[model samples]
Target: EKVAVVKEEVRSAAYKANVVKAERDALRLSLSVQETTQKKQVEQLQTLIEVAKAGNQDYSISNEESIKQTLNVSEQLNEQAHAEMQEMRAKIARLEANASSEIQNLEQKVKVVEAVLVGEVPAKRMRRRVKTKMKAAGV
Candidate 1:
């Protein structure tokens, strides 16, 4: 009976671990996809910029200022896109770290629960006390 219980607990731990790993992998894959898309967009922008520069040599006197203004707008857009990409990457890093921490805590709780069920001294209580604390604070 004891061996059966241990085996079940180990299986549960393995399942939870796999879930955590899968979640992390999914997030990483999403970041990779976003990065690839951003890279293509940047490359396209550079090609367009080069094309405009090439066309500038044939510009008329009256159209020169208009062309310059258009170039300025394109430059601004490129800068904004770059800035937004940086911001998004930063957010992804933070979210990945938070998810990793949560997964670790969950694994620890599972270990504690397994230990307690096997009549061992639990290293830490597995109960989620946060809900009680939140209710007390009227959250």
Candidate 2:
């Protein structure tokens, strides 16, 4: 019974670990997509700036300022995203470590329970039986 309960606890911990891993993977994929989109936007803005520079001076200057502002905002957003990703990575690492520790502890408990069960009659029972037999034998 104790072994069964321990096995169930182990299974629960494994399931929780898998769920956390899946969530982390999904977050990573989202961050990657956001980065790719940001890069494309920056490339497009650069191309526009080049075209503007080759055309009108006044128009180019205004567009340049606007582009600079946009670039700054994009850079800020990217930095924020990076920070969030780092924080999430750290959180996942901690969670993984905790789950690993819990699983190890549970496995150890299961081993101890199995060892005790394998001994058939428990040590105390065997000792008591020995005493009873010794008394009967007038020893």
Top lDDT hit: 2
TM-score of 1: 0.48
Q: What is the TM-score of each candidate against the true structure?
A: 0.48, 0.81
Q: Give the Cα lDDT of each candidate.
A: 0.57, 0.78
Query: Candidate 1 residues 1-139, lDDT tens each?
Result: 5335545555665665566667657666766676576666656666665676677776465554565566566666666666766676676666656666655544454454445456564233423453343344332
Cα error, candidate 2, residue 37 (Å): 1.1
lDDT value, candidate 2, whole model: 0.78
> Could you give candidate 2's per-residue lDDT for residues 31-114 as a string of tens digits?
899889888888888888888888766775667999989988888888888899899889989988888887777776666565
Q: Quick one: how many clashes does candidate 1 have?
A: 0
Worst 10 residues of 2 by lDDT: 130-139
